[model samples]
Target: MPLVDKLLILAIGAQVFLAIAILVLMGRERVPRVMSGEIPVADIAVERSGYPLKARLLSNSFDNQFQLPVLFFVGALLLLQLGFVSWVDVLLAWLFVALRIAHAAIHVTSNDVPRRFAAYSAGLAVLTLFWLWLLIRILLVPSA
Candidate 1:
């Protein structure tokens, strides 16, 4: 498989793992709160602490994975289908994945807005470039 394909798979895997982690975090906090009668139910409502800070952060991070990253997934698949794999595309795809991971880390750990924004912006830029490169390749290369 091409490096871009591998990276795309890994990025999808990261989203799945992050979702599981978010569920675990929610259970960890909600179970205890409910058992101790602090919260009447295992609900993530604004009234009941709103899923704790960490859980909320992880949930938000998980949500972000589904947004712009969808473009990366579609771009990679389009490149594969078009038989236009290149090192430049692979590198950009990997860069986007790394930046997204960094963004999630900053978001879930310190919840620092500026740091997370920097990472998110970098990832979005890479993804945009990847799509542009794909367009260029498709327009210039003749079909097989």
Candidate 2:
């Protein structure tokens, strides 16, 4: 496997860890109530709190991170088969993974919406670029 593939696997592991943390945090009666059902009266008035805001942010970050790896994995495999893998693809894959980690840290620690949004935008841009790169590369090259 290429280094990019290894990095993607690491991203998967990070995502799984975050997902488990989210599940544990959300299992709490207070958080689960807000997430699943109607807001309890105490929650409405007092604002039920658990796991802090950072955990929630991490949860969202993980969710976003989970989708990109799956897409990138497919793209990588297709590109590999085509014998057209490029440094750009690997760079973009790593960029997306790095941004996701930063996003999660910012979300969980400082709850910085602007920073999170910026990271998310960057990740999305990388994804778009990767898709375009793959499509153009495959289309422009003759089939074997």
Candidate 3:
């Protein structure tokens, strides 16, 4: 397998870890209820003391992180199939992962909305760059 493929797999693993962390944090007996479903809000509030605001925000950040990896995986596959692997691709992929981890850490620990937002914005920028690079490469490079 190629290095990019390895990186992509690693990205998926990181996402899974983030998801599990979110689950565990919510399991803590202090998280609040914000979802609506068959389970009553009161029941949720009672069952779990409910998460701190920071925990909830961190979970949401992880959710976003979880989604980005899927998109990156698809983009990576497409790029590899097309035979174009650049530093930008690798850097952007890893950048997204790093930013997300940092975002989750800041959010969970300090409820630092501004810092978290900055990290999220950086991740978004990387994703946008990936898409643009893919588009440009596909259009400018001749098909095999």
How does each model score on TM-score?
0.78, 0.62, 0.70
- Candidates 2 and 3 compared by TM-score, better number: 3
Candidate 3 local Cα displacement, residue 11, angstroms: 2.6
Alpha-carbon error at 13 in model 3, in Å?
A: 2.4
Error of 2 at 37 (Å): 19
TM-score winner between candidates 1 and 3: 1
Task: Evaluate model 3: give its TM-score.
Answer: 0.70
Residues 1-144, candidate 3, lDDT per residue (tens digit)? 677766765765775687678668755523334553434566446443245455556556556655766777688778777667776787777777787778778877876779978987888788889889989988987767
Residues 69-102, model 2: lDDT tens digits: 5676677667767666666777776676677667
lDDT of 2 at 136: 94
Off by over 4 Å in 3: 29-41, 45-55, 66-70, 80-83
Q: What is the C-alpha lDDT of each candidate?
A: 0.76, 0.65, 0.70
Q: Model 1 — which ten-residue stretch has the worst lDDT?
A: 42-51
Give candidate 2 misplaced runs (Cα > 4 Å): 1-52
Ranking by TM-score, best first? 1, 3, 2
What residue pairs are clashing in model 2? 54-108
